[model samples]
Target: MNLRLYDTAARSVRDFEPLQPGRASIYLCGATVQAPPHVGHIRSGLAFDILRRWLQASGYDVTFVRNVTDIDDKILQRGTDEGIPFWQVAMRNERAFTWAYDQLGCLPPTYEPRATGHVPEMVELMQRLIDAGHAYPADGDVYFDVRSLPEYGALSGQRLDDMQPAADSDAQIKRDPRDFALWKSAKPGEPQWHTPWGPGRPGWHLECSAMASRYLGPAFDIHGGGMDLLFPHHENEIAQSKAAGDSFAQYWMHNAWVTTSGEKMSKSLGNSLLVSEVVQRVRPVELRYYLGSAHYRSMLEFSDEAMSEAAAGYRRIEGFVRRAEESLGMPESVPVPDAFAAAMNDDLGVPQALAVVHDTVRVGNAALAADELVGAREARDEVVAMLDVLGLNPYAPPWAAQSDDGAARRALGPLVDVVLAQRAAARDRKDFAVADALRDGLAASGIVVEDTPAGPRWSLAEEI
Candidate 1:
């Protein structure tokens, strides 16, 4: 495989070589499930989803494990605020995240392990660290001795002395302020699991390490998450896993955040655009195209204008695909264009790859206009193949069902016809101004009115 990826640990683009031949193992740090996912939250999922699709397209058997942090401080807090059990809070929000992922057409992971369900694995990993003298228990809590590992700060590229204290636990009990908790001591009214040290819950960073090892083994091809997790979460995972004498995460990949008003979109910042709400304004497939259109490593700034522009851009490609299929019927997907594959191989360059998609769309549109069946069919095949790699194939399952739904068109027909009748009456009376106004109004609402020789015809605008 010629695929190369930007490794966060190496701080450079590196050639991707799977640990095992013809197989790729990826563990993506998934949602914490404290609340419904915002667009910012789902961006990471979509970014990694593209990677998963590309790997499969490239002929690698991929094992993708995306873990859920079901038990966390925020989850507990949300439960308290809602007057419900923490488990209930976690489950409700987890479903929301799952829905968001599915709505955007993200492929489900090979194993979606929850942290609370894997206590036994966490306990075993904690025991290994303790026996190896890299972790110790104090006051019913297990803490990883950060100084024990000489290469502790390698992942984050920070010197031990310059680093800030690990704020995961109280400084009074830890031997060093930098030591992070493997297990937090059980607190009143909180969930707990029995461990040799005491009854407590797994720490945030510890959950991922244990879950990744459980499904993908100790040494896997890649570990991925958002850029915000690079400091404490991913760095801690690296220290604990390596200190336990395991070669974990051969390559580290972190996607950039979705920002709003120059700030990272977060609930605390009060700038998050929820996936459910955003999809109400735009089609789910259009939202997916907007989010995945940018490079995975580039920060995508959110704006209504930007999103509208992206929707228009996607509509152009979809327009060509639909037109070509009408002229040439459905074409079998051929291998992706060389330019598209080359861009994808170069560190998942979606921006460049999308350029290839648009270029093909242009070619297909020209072929259709000239009534060249052979050229149109070839372009359609290439376009479908490229879109499939990017997980944006409109003719594919999910999106196809969405596109072919007659119920919506049927429901909308009567209302649209009423308006069309009024417009026709105004036109018959030579009230051109009123008729044009009504037609423009319908177009603004994404309804196109065509005055044909047979009769007036109405259809939903493609851009919407």
Candidate 2:
């Protein structure tokens, strides 16, 4: 099956032909670890995750690389306020992001190269640019010479003459105001590493190039991130890498930013919905469905009302899969429809693919109702595969536990005895509300409180 993806380069959809036959290489610019993930953060990754799923489903070996930016101006600014090292802030937020990613069912990347972990690679890349005369070092700071790269504005479609200088420069080092930083010379108390030039840190655009090249190679199949990065961030990456004599990304993919109240969601707006808080309100799979229901280039507005609407649509798919599974007696066979393949092949049109799934359910349900068990069997199999491809199996409950935690619970030792004593005291005093609330709260957070015949035993709920 041919995979058609929307390439931001062409501003149109095109068939995806891997550089290496039957394989894919992808580099996704990950979050800067200054804050935890919000709904907006997940949108870009989940969109590409869907693309990864489809490619794998079509028998492509996928190597996905997502980089973590540990060193940033924001982390330094916040750290200065808190009186702690900026690296500490980065580590704390990186763990928070890992939790958010797991809650949303995103696959772990093959390599999660932290920017701080790859300074040597960054120094090497900077040297290539400098040696190529595309970058020049002045006053210990290395700046990319935008004029040296003729195709600088080709990706962003912004000409150098039209770009206004962001801020007034010192007027001594930079030949053109349009030139951006490749490496920043170390300032006192800032995070720094010893480089060929001096002690300094890598710039934002240079980090991705170094990390991507180290993991995936000089050229990869696709590079994706939020549409906001299409400008200076990704454009600089293209300029810096090509100037260094390495072919950068072959295909560029950018998903539209998630919006709220008719505006793009951003930390600066104070309107962002954190992923952890959202997971508390809406199930992860439901949230995924809501975020992914529209075209990748379209803005997704999320609210309680929007979530409820998505749940309604998702419930339809869930209801169909559930009924089909029950009535068909777990049929092993499912027929693939030409319509299903065609829809997916057409720029990965999820909406059209969904229509085929629902159509299968319609015919599958009717056949089951009429006792046409054989026809129902084929439909059931097709629905299963479709759900698998979409990462949403309607029948699976949202909050299911995937681990056996009984041994760890038993190892609590003295804490378990103390809790048991408290439970007995609560029963004797008739203060059942505290006891009940404790049990119920645990159950709500994916812990199942079971009043077994022996005693109160707790375990994890079924993981969806």
Candidate 3:
């Protein structure tokens, strides 16, 4: 099980040797809880899940910690706007995120600590930062002074002098423009806790630092998140942790963004697609295949053609699964090809890994047709084992509901009725334009609006 991963700190791939003998600790940044997760978020989860599954399979005891950022300015604002407690909005979306994770077949972490639940730890961390002169109190806010930490920009590789100040940051809280907050003073309508400094909440970066250290330890194996957080988010985490005179983690891993139509996929962009919505169309397992078919560090631009290809690819695996089941009566042992292990060991090169899957399926199918059940089962189990690395269990989907698809379609009756009425009005007025537009709108919402003789009938779209 010799494996190596690309380390962001070193800017290169190195052999992954744990500090202790057979133990791996991972601290992956989880959802912010501001909104439901989009396709972009699933990519990071799947990439790390690959690492986690690999380590676990290699006889290593892995402690994975993925935090839920239940407290943030956006959440506070949303709660205020909706007239609900801040926790309400975060909890609602956190559940949605978990569903999305299930839909995408991403394995859940060992410890999912919420940011709000660990305020005491966060305050303790802030106190250490303040005592070490790495951070200071300014007007009720505690800020991490970027100039105070000499190696501040190491993670992002950006120098303090060369960087421009962030426009959205609090100008008064920072001694220098590059400095960021460790503790945010509670404003009216925002959630707060009592602390020695004042009544306030933990800043975004410090929450991860505190939660990660508490769960994974001061020094751990990998700390991963999206590449966009490289600058102030991860850089600030590095500074605060080091200032506390403790190492944060061994390898820094950041997954690249997901793109759609040449733009970064995001809910704010209105072009973002939800993993749950996607699962409604295709088998959630196939969505995992589609996402895992690309390199972790490369930007994957998703489209209908790519999805169709993934569906076709998944059908091949399904055929192998069905064939393996049929040939269980024969006697022979098929071996898993070395190509699969080789590709997977190379920093989870799933594109190549999937190619190995194809080859294994081809070989196993030939053996199965020749009445070799023992080897076919072994080969099928081998493929399933590799699939586990990417969090696709091949048995059950995380996003799959216990109820029938028919029942789920019935649940969408009200929404479907609204869409049909709008579409019917457009058709009765002899305006095919509005009718077509209505149909497209319904399809985008995961509803397939079809025009039948009985009128518009709706079902969940297959490629949602």
Number of the top candidate by TM-score? 1
Clash pairs, model 1 backbone? none
- Model 1 regions more than 4 Å off: 166-169, 408-446, 449-458, 462-464
Residues 153-272, candidate 3, lDDT per residue (tens digit)? Answer: 988888988888678547855788777888888887577899888899888899899888898778888899999888778888888899998788899999998899999998788988
Q: lDDT of each model, Cα atoms only?
A: 0.91, 0.81, 0.81
**Would you estimate the TM-scores of all the predictions?**
0.92, 0.84, 0.83
Q: List the residue pairs that clash in candidate 2.
A: 400-462, 400-463, 400-464, 401-462, 401-463
lDDT tens digits, residues 1-464, model 1?
A: 39999999999999999999999999999999988999998999999999999999999999999989998888888888989999999999999999999999999999999999999999999999999999999999899999899998899999999976556448888878989889998899888888899899888899999989999888999999999999889999999999998899999999999999898999898889999999988888889999999998999999989999999998889878876776688869699999999999999999999999999988888888788889989988999999998888998867999888589789988998998899989999999999999999999988888785457877677553
Number of the top candidate by lDDT? 1
Model 1 lDDT at residue 336: 95
In candidate 3 the C-alpha lDDT for residue 286 amounts to 76
Q: What is the C-alpha RMSD of each candidate to the true structure, in Å?
A: 3.1, 8.0, 9.9
